[model samples]
Target: MDTLCFHDGNITDLIESRTLDVRYDINHNLQMHSSLIRRLSQERELEGHLGCVNAVAWNSKGSLLISGSDDTRINIWSYSSRELLHSIETGHSANIFCTKFVPETSDELVVSGAGDAEVRLFNLSRLKGRGPEENAISPSGVFQCHSKRVKKLAVEVGNPNVVWSASEDGTLRQHDFREGASCPPGGSSRQECRNVLLDLRCGAKKSLADPPKQSLALKSCDISSTRPHLLLVGGSDAFARLYDRRMLPPLSSCRKKLSPPPCVNYFCPMHLSDHGRSSLHLTHVTFSPNGEEVLLSYSGEHVYLMDVNHAGGSAMQYTSADASKVMSFAPIVNGVELQSSASSGFPSGSLKSNVAATLDKCRKLVQIAEKSLKEGTNYFHGIEACNEVLDGHGRLIGPMLMHECLCIRAALLLKRKWKNDAHMAIRDCHRARRIDSSSFRALYLLSEALSQVSSMIFIVIGYLAIYDWQHDAKMTY
Candidate 1:
């Protein structure tokens, strides 16, 4: 028999997927750190699920661990006994997209969203320790949050009752649990019940496009602790948009609109990379707990970090000099030095030095372009100024130039109604792909530009056909 081995840090444990329900810790570190620790594992291999486990969340007091799956089931596990506590079967008809444990609550309240266009809340406290009872683990309430699949979820750091969700529908919604009563009587309309129990409305007006057909769906979002009411959403857009939740309509129009001022002074749109002709679709976007900076993980092995304060109209970008794929990033608190072999080859000193030099040059070029544009000088001169920066450091500045050029070309085509040029611009985004095929931003932009161009072409053809038919009718008469 081939034995399976499990090893993490100073711990090692193994289990046969098909066998027993026994839970044991082969290593002693968990026992040593018992005050704030727990562990669990999936003993049985769920047969029908198609994908591997994506994420795991622990309830406030670490009592339950909610596991979201591509299998479309949210499995609630008991942390103490490491047993499969409960399985919430409804709410999401498609792949169980995202599951979050609402903070500051003793009740096992888990919120989940799926590809089926719904967000559901399960009050697991009502069914805690009840193994699969007929009604146990079912959703206590549901919110038809988005018109498309919900892809990511985040709970406000300062307030647990406030939750935010991102979806393929191109919208992010904020849910306020403080506004309503919990667990209304059965048979109440889901919409009515949700409106009563949870105030669900679009938190931000920013939208996200779907990823390339060849890539995985967007699955990244994060909230800022330092900047309350500011939510960061990342998707196929390659860029992340930060919105002041307070400015969102419905909520902004509500009585709470007069609440205290928000922590975030202002948020500007920031681009992650300037590479690839196609917009690099970002798989995930995250901010440091301090809200001083942000990071993005794009498809095609690109990971970047940006100082949010420096992300202005001028292009800002950072790439790992050694080129290792950064899957994700967690906050670095205190002065602890946590180094990884992943970034070992890339010297931080050199990387920062190069970035500063490149940014300085780009800034100068931008200033010149702005001056020319403002002075009513030839637009080509401004273009030429930008082109000079692009030519000298194309490899280092290609990503930014591509974005700037696309914006310029897109604006021109939109104004001229030249649908083919816009379509060609998107197709040419493939140039970015050649530089970095895994860039989610490029993939996303290409897809969006393609969609827009396709729609415009269809409408133009329809109008021309109608015009020709009218002309023919007049001649026949």
Candidate 2:
């Protein structure tokens, strides 16, 4: 913080009139830590998976978390108990890529797709208790259609029978399980059938005259939360294409008669605006919970956020379907000044220019962090950026920047929603409160963090009480 005193006449006159208070207010308002160890503050990594984890999903009420790994195993865990409820050794010979709990199944069924190009189901209802890993247990049902790796799986709300899979063979197919899984007596699981929902190769062909020969391997797919018919399929290209499933060609339409799928909207970053950016492909694309926005992640590139509602020119021009207005959370690794801070009103000292330099540095970092929060995806990276601001500013950061940094971190940690994230967020709030006694944001974040922790604390206390009561009963007997 820079301080300047305005004197109407001379320094002697100003001194005689009054002594400027350098830090009286700040010093008086500064607070101290609680001085107790944060026992509840923690970070946990469930070490159940032997290989790289590829997919995870929460069951209907979010009471259970299921993870699929390259080890060909799936682990079902209870979030409340923080324990593994079941582990299934999927007999697939290849790496599992995508997994999700089937909707409206009461978390009884989970579907997974693997590099073997097969989508299969695991019946959690049959795998009772947290027993040892069951070996070679046959899948409840199987989907055998694609010829390449299955990279993504999507499920529609209120429909347990419909599951969508995207594959490296350039096909997005829908599998129906209702006919087989809801078996009439001892009906065979072979009754399940798969339909070619969207052949990426045929739908991507520009026109009927252009041969549908070129194929791009799909990497991810998602269904909009609000509108079930709106779907997204992202793959080995710079753009993630959105389509309304209702407009897709009929099931009876042969490959020769199928027309190009009319793209609802295109999401691409300005940096990779054209098809020439084939080197940059999307690793993942997902819709916002409210279904008004989309988040696209490019392989080895910064994630981009776009609001589809505000994209340019809804007047359907498929050839130049461009929506490049995107916000990115790219970090400035080098000390690069893309723009001058002259207009930002930061103090500039003619004698010592270091103050202005320092302020600009922290300001840019803070801006990057705030942008990530506003983007509403990749909160972890935002927290990392906020950390750099606090650490790179040395042991004594300016009160203004420190307070801002703390608030940014608190907001990010809360958004991240990782294990014990609330405790850390609460600490950041306290630090911000110490820096600024009248900070409304700090108080607000504290309350939000406390609300999350309160329930968690109650659960922990209940478990402890149960243990104590059981011990007392054993001793009395």
The prediction achieving the highest TM-score against the true structure is 2
Q: Which stretches of candidate 2 lie over 4 Å from their true place?
A: 1-42, 134-136, 179-194, 202-213, 252-259, 312-477
- Model 2 — which ten-residue stretch has the worst lDDT? 1-10
In the range 82-140, model 1's lDDT, one tens digit per residue, is: 77766666546787767898776664567887777677887767764466434445566
* Model 2, span 1-477: residue lDDT tens: 111111121233223223322432322122211212323466566778899999998887889999999999988888988887777888778999999999998898899999988888877777664375653467888766666899999999899888888988777877788645321111134422336677666444322223334576899999997998999988876667888999887542112324446677666654355324336688998998778778888887777778766653221122332333231222322433233211223333441254445556667778878998999988977787777667544332367878888899999999898865786787777666655556899989999998987887688679879999999999999
| lDDT against the true structure, each candidate | 0.52, 0.69
10 residues in a row with least lDDT, candidate 1: 1-10
- Could you tell me the TM-score of candidate 2? 0.56
